[model samples]
Target: MLGFLTARQAGVDDPLRLRRVESTRRVLSLKLNPDRDVDRIHGNGINTIDIEAVEGRYMLSGGADGVIVIYDLENFGGKQQYTCKAVSTVGSRHVHKFSVETVQWYPYDTGMFISSSFDKTMKVWDTETLKVMKVPDRLLPSALSLPLSFSLFSASCVLTFPCHKVPYGHRAEVLSVRWSPRYEHILASASADSQVKVWDVRRASCSLLTLDQHNGDKSKASSEAVNTAHNGRVNGLCFSGDGLYLLTTGTDDRMRLWNSATGENTLVNYGKVCNESRKRLQFTVSRGCSPEFVFVPCGSSVAVYALHTGQLVTMLRGHYNNVDCCEFHPDYQELYSGGKDCNILAWVPVLRASDVEEESDRCGRTALVNPAFQDAWSSDED
Candidate 1:
């Protein structure tokens, strides 16, 4: 980090390069922070959490208890020991009849947000009033609304296409859905049927691409495995920051990377991700890092993996039970994970004093090297 700063000061490197380098270092050094806590309001397991993108100062969490809570993440008191306080909650009245599967803040505005649940219903909320603004159409009778199922959100109406009615809809339940970060109309959906499909919302008659794990290699595919993205249920789906690559995890205990544009499997082997979740798994990717990282919920730990190479970076091991969701705060380079332990743990970047000390020690050692043993060619020539 010092070297990067020196280069930036000398105008020898781009300012953006220094930022990326520091961000990557911070992400790599993430550890469970003792000073930070999120108020535990959920009586049951947390299934989903989303940090608002507008200000990155507020967070939303939905739990299996059919409750939704909004937390103020900004530390206004200027203290290291800080707890994110629950500013508002939708607790008793008008709560979902079953587990709340997903909650997301409105991208352009913090005044509203949306949530869906297993109760076959979706609700849009007015953040200030903490009241249900509208209950959108009930989910399809056969469709249990899992996390990441909703397609679109607007200020007035929450729209979800009955993709089940499409020409090539999944026969089984859809487990996850993600919109491309690069393209507004392009969407991806994964299903319990082991298939991943990309759709253009404008042309909803049929999917645009059906990802094949085999990448059309006839010799590697059997009749049943021809077009499937995984051998078992594909429950997790996350797109890289640039939306060029897609990462998926399945009940088969494996994660695979895919080329989003062509629907071809990149075949970077991320070994045994150990995903057994029957519901949608929420994972996230780092935004400003060069070789970006993916934070995934693996049983009781959140597994960090390199985005392109699929190498397991590290495992965050604080949750006592199975972790259901993990979210990354890009601005702060911090991570928040929720689990069946009924706790929300914060992973923060450790201090850099040790790095400075190491650098100084190396310099001191070089200076103390024996003068007689040192090469004197340069001194002699001078």
Candidate 2:
């Protein structure tokens, strides 16, 4: 029966069979969004999803309910939908009192992971033990007494390991945090107080540079101490592929690019794009090529833009609800996007020669009477 189907469906043309096989390979080889509707496990929505940098075989997801799950992407059990069995959990009882804001694997290892929470603490957990690996110290400064009135302030150092913990800078809740892809010792963070900070994990002194809204002039250099590129809360930040540039998005309905080394704003404007508002609008940079592109999570669709020019090239539309995050697959020219709709969509470029030929033929001129040909045949004018 199998032999008959192969002969009848594939026919005798070897070339056609080969092309059909290649097309199927490309489609199936693309990654899936992994929208596991396992509400039975975690009652709330997923807040973060991260793919392992080295193997790309496993994925990590953190939910609003403070549940962390590890998913195996490879299908080995011959199942229709790739089953993502939960490897371990922190449990709902001991989970973060607030939402789990971020989840990231150790840059160099697979047995450890880090997660941050609105509870005002970041925890590094041993993936094998499912327990906290390191917990840094905390410090609170004395209340300042002003001439007119007294203002209160407190400081805490969240747990970050493989480095000393003396003074973790943010005085308020940390909104977003990321490790440097190149230098593992360097970490960057954004806060609710409208500040961006760079920290060297080696020392806990003051932040390397405090990005504030007021430097000098609001239009020129921020009049404040830290540079404030966004008029509202700067919720999202990402380093460019080459680590030369940093991209930021805010509630101001705009995206801006900056020189990471000099802390200078590039001022590339993305006009009136609605952000996730409350959640972090994660963005990713495409690797390779002369001109690189940034994939930004804009409302219901993902916007692809040129890095330096800030020109809007194209918009990918498929999500029924607002898109929360997106990442570019470096191995293939494919895109993986996920949203509030609880579904992930994989987009592959359609590049068949026959498809292009059909489009060209449809637009080609069919009229036989050519103006140039008629003009040449006309009798000589007086």
Candidate 3:
């Protein structure tokens, strides 16, 4: 970090260097945050979580019991015992016929959110009224709304499109849905049918491209016309932070990366990515770091892998049951994961070696105390 300051002082214009240094420091510091606590709000397994892209002060979480919770992450109490409180909730009796598969805040505003579920529906909610507004069959609405991406399935859906309506579509349950990070009209979906299809929602007639295991090349295994991304259920879909590449994982115990623009399977071979998840397994990518990493929920743990090469880096093992989702907070290089155990664990970077020694030397010979941040810079958030 000191070297980054020195480089800036020398008038060097390398943002990549700064990012790499910062990312490494942040990744190394990651340890379970014990000083703070998130209120135990979910009565069932937590399925999905999303931090608002605006202020980053609030976080939204959805659970298998059809519950939606909003947590205030701000440390207003200014102490270690401070607990993140649930500012609001949308309970099970009101909406969603089944488990909420995903929950996300509007990209540009906190006034709205989008969620999907196992009930074959997706709903857009007005945060102020706690009422949902119906849009087109497309999960998001309008031209600019294209970038406001989140989750896919829901039971009581507003943006309803039946299977028979499309010319060509998957023959099984659409487990996951994601909007292209780069293209406004492009949408991606994974299914129990083991295929990944990209659709241009504007036309809504047919998918632009159907991804294949052989990268559209005709092989003895299958023909080009019949494209299958995986031999098993594809449950997870995520685009890279920069939107250049798309990453997918399946029940086949494999992970594949693809070219988003052309829908060509890059076949990066993330070997044996054990996934027994019948529903969507939410994962995320790290940004501002060269050789960025992909974080995936691997049953009882969150597995960190080198994005390009597919090498397993480390496993985050705080969860007692199968972990369903993990979200990366790039602001402070932190991670928050949810699982079937019904726990939300916060992972923040551990203090530096020198900083630890400094604190320990100051304390005494008895206990080596880990430090907590006070007056932490929440200003850079979002």
Best-fitting candidate, scored by lDDT = 1
Candidate 3, RMSD to the unseen true structure: 7.8
Clashing pairs in 3: 29-349, 29-350, 30-349, 116-153, 117-153, 117-154, 119-155, 121-154
What's the true lDDT of residue 237 in model 2?
Answer: 78
| Model 1 Cα lDDT, one tens digit per residue, 190-304 | 8877888887776636678889988898788876733899988888888898989988889999899999999999999888898989988999998898668899999999998
Give residue 49's lDDT in candidate 3 (0 to 100).
Answer: 93
Q: For this target, which candidate reaches the highest TM-score against the unseen true structure?
A: 1
Task: Put down candidate 3 lDDT per residue, 1-382, tens digits, no spaces.
Answer: 4556666667773656666656744654467788877888998999999988788788889999999888988888778667888899999866588898888887889998887776766678888888888666664346334575555543212223444564366777677778877876777888877888887777735677778778645654453356888889999999998788888899999999998888887867677888999988899998766557788999899888768767665788888999999898887778889999988888887776785444334322221221121111111222
Error of 2 at 304 (Å): 1.9
The positional error of residue 221 in candidate 1, measured at the CA in angstroms, is 1.6
Across 1-382, the per-residue lDDT of candidate 2 in tens digits comes to 2333355466743444333333322322233334332223455655566666667666676667777777665557776445456566676456577767577776457787777666656667788888887543431111111001100111224422233655445545455666555555655666555667776656636667665433345576644544555677667878886677777778878777767776667766667767755656667777652245678888788887657767664677877878777766555545666566755466654535564344223222211232221211222221
C-alpha lDDT of all candidate models, in order: 0.79, 0.58, 0.76
Candidate 2 Cα deviation (angstroms), residue 119: 2.8
Runs in model 1 lying further than 4 Å from the true structure = 135-166, 355-382
Specify the poorest-scoring 10-residue window by lDDT in model 3.
370-379
